[model samples]
Target: MRPAIIRKPAEQSVTPNWDDSAAARAAFSWQAQAGELCGLPGGGLNLAYEAVDRHAQGRRRQHVALRLLDRNGGRCDISYARLSSLSNRFANVLKGLGVQPGERLFVLCGRGLELYLGVLGGLKLGCVVCPLFSAFGPEPIETRLRIGEGSVLLTSEALYRRKVAGIRERLPQLRQVLLYEDNGGAVDTPPGTLSLAQLLAEASDDFAITPTTADTPALLHFTSGTTGTPKGALHVHGAALTHLVTGKYALDLHPDDIYWCSADPGWVTGTSYGILAPLLLGVTSVVDSGEFDAERWYSILETQGVSVWYTAPTAIRMLMKAGAELARRHRFPRLRFIASVGEPLNPEAVWWGQDVLGLPIHDNWWQTETGGIMLANTLAMPIKPGSMGKPLPGVEAAIVSRDEQGGLILLGDETVGELALKQPWPALFRGYLGQEERYRRCFVGDWYLSGDLARRDADGYYWFVGRSDDVIKSAGHLIGPFEVESALLEHPAVAEAAVIGLPDALLGETVKAFVSLKSGIEPSAALHDELLGHGRKRLGAAVAPKALAFLPDLPRTRSGKLMRRLLKARELGLPEGDTSTLENPR
Candidate 1:
């Protein structure tokens, strides 16, 4: 409802990576970005070599690459030379176990020194590294391991006994299990499992990184759909360039700045930005192994002198609910830039940052399939609430509809259509592992259909509608759940909301919403009536939810996205398919 808030550089005159968008795009090329990273000692490219060895052999050898804080309130800093030596030890350990190049290796531990070393080490050995969420149940873990044909697993002794031991028999391809002490060596090692610490102790600290080209597979990230098997999004070593480019432009990382990305390594954002990007830039990356706590987070930003912070909207909303007064308790003078990903942040959150934190949260858009950021509201650009800003310099985006003849028809500004990208970007996922037919359906030709509906405004800002499957058709009106959810979030009492379409014989489908109130607010009939009236006022009657209900909390994925499809399935009593990824399936 308000005009776009034009951002002004502060009194100190903060300079961004690039000020001009058009000129930057014209000058951008994948070749030049790749040239930024020193390739292997020979002529090929390896992610670990570029991210670790290059920095280790250069002036940043003594500079802290990872500033780690464990859950038990312990602190440690690993420099580039230290990281290189440790990762080389890990690579030698893997080689001793006969883990071959191109073989799939899974890292299934919490955020710590081992998780970081395992990923970089696997890449150095030319093994395809996949990081699984530490909080995942046994089924999800087993599914990913089986689908990915995991050859080796790097985990903690406790996790190995509790989560992986029961499912290890199901995976014949998983020949080796390397375990470490996640909780300060409190748990004893189980039989048939090798100790990672002992292996590292026996292995040499120097090893040559395996020769790899740009197309050599380095990362395999699994993304689950609403139904069916999970898709393994495979990425090559060349994606480091995209990570480097996006990190500088979207996140605005500086050499002297201490950057923290709160996402876990289980996700793509964590691997690309949390690990490779920061290391590629030779910046110190702060890794917190602890869970989310508002006071703890505020303390980190203040004490660590974090200049750039990237996190998810779910954590941001929780911090917002804790109230701005709590944030005022700790001052973050060095926290210059903050950005959010994983969800389309509501307009209210964008304004909250400006009002409370003295800076607007720039929201960037990308997916697990894309491997890196595609569109973003850069620091130099004006803040448009709830809009995914212009495309990355080397990326091209469009809204298009398929014609009857199976050709693509590009739409004009303000017209909603399936979001598509002109492909062949460095980080573009090469395949979906085993599902060739399913991967083929995602593209008509060169345009990779995103399966989400969106519209581009005259100012080149793209607004998220809803996923193609999640869009609601009610009384001849196309309704995007995001619009209704955003409106409901504007209310003070509402903490979270999820919208879906339910069956209606008369109207075809009707808009319905489920809301979770703020911390102490209980469900009440009067409050329900008030929320319905508020929705009607914000969005006209036709687009507003015809029915509304209060829930303790809505279902969400580990990445903090609402599971709208699951909500609809429960409403209709249809078979809830593939509920493996739900944070609260109960």
Candidate 2:
């Protein structure tokens, strides 16, 4: 099948000769296609085969592929040889259960050996895999099952009995349920359910992998929308090639580097960096299959000699709260790089990382549709504190001004406007699965509308402002919510905050803040004054919140991202649209 990404305008543009090394050049070369440079060829390869089988074929069979740490301090060191065999056996088990190629299969489990094997097995058989976060309740799970038309569910018996048992009646497409346990008793299989081990025992590991081309849809990643219902973003095999290029060049991943991405496999970050990127670079991936603790994470960095660490800004802030003395005592001798995603890192977080961890947390930016990191701070370049840095080589970005006439005018240096990509890279998603019209509208003229607002400096650095739809229009002043939110977070009493534009009698739309206070902090009229005063002092009176409401917690998605739209919906008493994307909505 021809690549569907070719339809994007970004895939039809001219590329510049960015002076890079031979390895970088070759990786970048694979990203170009259809008279445009976007993605690479996977050598007709499956990520599971490349990550496990290819590594095991050579003399380096004993090399450790995964280091899994359990909740009780137990550690399991898995070799590439064992991983290949286990994955192959599991693939046979899937086939025995009557699952076919081109079928949609869902895996709802935590980050462990079983989760990895299940995902790999499904891919090897040419089934599109949809991985959901284990933390999600039955509502979100059922929504995914219905939307995906899932044929089978690979989950723990405990979770099946608790979450899936009640919702099974709603999912008609679900034909079978497989448990990931050894204890096979007279437990209720719900008519068609079966045991995972029993099926594997009857099947053979000698089965051949199904032939899948680059254009075949490989993954169906549901974006955790902070506003509306989650949209499943479809990614193809060709997009995998771009993921390799991005991880290698943009993140500057090295083969010898022991990479640890602390993102859950449920989100896009997990798929892009945790699974695809590390495997493509042929690096040893460290997996901590347990809850995150500050000291434990630091210990992982010190004990494992992890060279590269990729995490979210929220995690960095949590570490900063633990104080720098603990970080000073930790010896991360092998750690050369640390990167942050999800949101642009605050200047304080960046400073704290450099001071405590001996490395600055380089901030990068991208969305679920973009596939991987489209903008990042390369190791060879100087680190900028708050900027998301320039566009990755082969990816084109611009800040275009939209006038009253709805014309998109490209903005010059130091000017703020809507951030849009001029070309589609290999990692770009084909379209929103089953939502063609909604996907088509995201592109304006020949560029993809990123919905983000940004400004480019004369030196080519792009600074993130906020989202276009979220921009606040007060009186005649246009304000980005991020600026005000960041200003409010700088205060000592504030743990987290969300700013939105509300209908006003005089100012047209006034800024309103819904804040979550820090521990031991009391929410009163005085604390409200203090928070607003802090914002006014830093961001000027124009962007300061006109009103403040104290909440115990902010509405967030299953992935721990704040959902400002939900708060807005509550404040206005408007009907909240599909909130399936949120873990806990107001």
Q: Pick the candidate with the highest TM-score.
A: 1
Question: Model 1, which residues run further than 4 Å from truth?
Answer: 11-13
lDDT of 1 by residue, 1-586 (tens): 7567677766223689867467777988888877698888778999999889999998999999999997766789999999999999999999998899999999998989999999999999999999999998899999999999998999998888889999888888889999998765644667667888888999999998999998999999988546777889999999988998999999989888899999989988889999999999999999999999999999899988999999998999989989889999989888888899988998888898888988788898999999999999988888799998888788899999999999999999999999999989988899998889988888988999999899999989899999999999998988999999999999889988999999799999999999989888888999999999999999999999989999987888887788999888898898888888777886
Candidates' lDDT values, in order? 0.90, 0.76
Alpha-carbon TM-score of each model against the true structure? 0.98, 0.89
Deviation of model 1 at 309, angstroms:
0.7
* C-alpha lDDT of candidate 2 relative to the true structure: 0.76
Find the candidate with the highest lDDT and give its number.
1
Model 1 reaches what TM-score against the true structure? 0.98
Candidate 2 lDDT tens digits, 1-586: 1110111223212221232444653555442522221221334656566556666776657777788877667778887788778888888888877789889989887788777877888888888888888878899899888888898889877778778999999898999788865233434555567777667667666657777766777788887754456688888766766777777766667767788999988888987788777766667888887777988999999888898899987778767666677788789888877889987676666666776877777788999888888887666556667778777767779999777887789989988898899756666787787789989978877788888898988868788887777778987888877777777877777767788889989988999998877667789988878887877888788878888999987777655566777778888998777677665554
Backbone clash count for every predicted candidate, in the order shown: 0, 8
Candidate 2 ranges beyond 4 A from true positions? 1-28, 31-43, 182-191, 402-407, 583-586
Q: How much is the lDDT of residue 31 in candidate 1?
A: 83
